[model samples]
Target: MTGTCGSCGRDDEDVVLVRRLYVTPEAWDTPGKVEQGDEERWCFVCRTHYPHEELGQA
Candidate 1:
């Protein structure tokens, strides 16, 4: 799918859906499980530049 990358905010055709892993404020102290944040579409360049868990194609 074609869309703006969530990371770099660049328009690209090869955008893909990725699951952003992050620790929530509530879980910061515990740090037991990493929470899955927003699923965003990212371009190939951003996807490579930033490490993220791939959910699938957008």
Candidate 2:
């Protein structure tokens, strides 16, 4: 799918649906509970270089 990456905001043809990038928080409301952020469309390059959980093809 060709679209803008949610991370880098770059146009790419290899964009796919992926979980939002995770950020380390100073404190967690519930420790040990993994919080998966919203899904977003991201280019393959950004997905490979950044921390993201793949959802599927966009």
Candidate 3:
């Protein structure tokens, strides 16, 4: 994946974290539809000078 780095003005694969959501289903072996309400975004260290801005307290 490619993204423009927020800082240093460079284009690279800076984001390292795997962006996804974890959901617990009522049944162990069944697949259920999930409501899209939350999204997790990840960026590289150099990209986010102020990392707190991207990863805020939930």
lDDT of each: 0.77, 0.77, 0.43
Measured against the true structure, the TM-scores of the candidates, in listed sequence, are: 0.63, 0.66, 0.27
Which pairs of residues collide in candidate 2? Answer: none
lDDT of 3 by residue, 1-58 (tens): 4654434345665543332333445687877544432334345655244322334312
Estimate candidate 3's alpha-carbon lDDT, on a 0 to 1 scale. 0.43
Question: Per lDDT, what order, best first?
Answer: 2, 1, 3
Clashing pairs in 3: none
Span of 10 residues, lowest total lDDT, candidate 3: 49-58
Question: Model 1 Cα RMSD, Å?
Answer: 3.8
List the lowest-lDDT window of 10 residues for candidate 2: 25-34
Mark the regions of model 1 whose C-alpha exceeds 4 Å error after superposition. 22-35
lDDT of 2 by residue, 1-58 (tens): 8888888888755788999756665555644435678888888788878777888874
Supply the TM-score for candidate 2.
0.66
| Candidate 1 Cα deviation (angstroms), residue 54 | 0.5
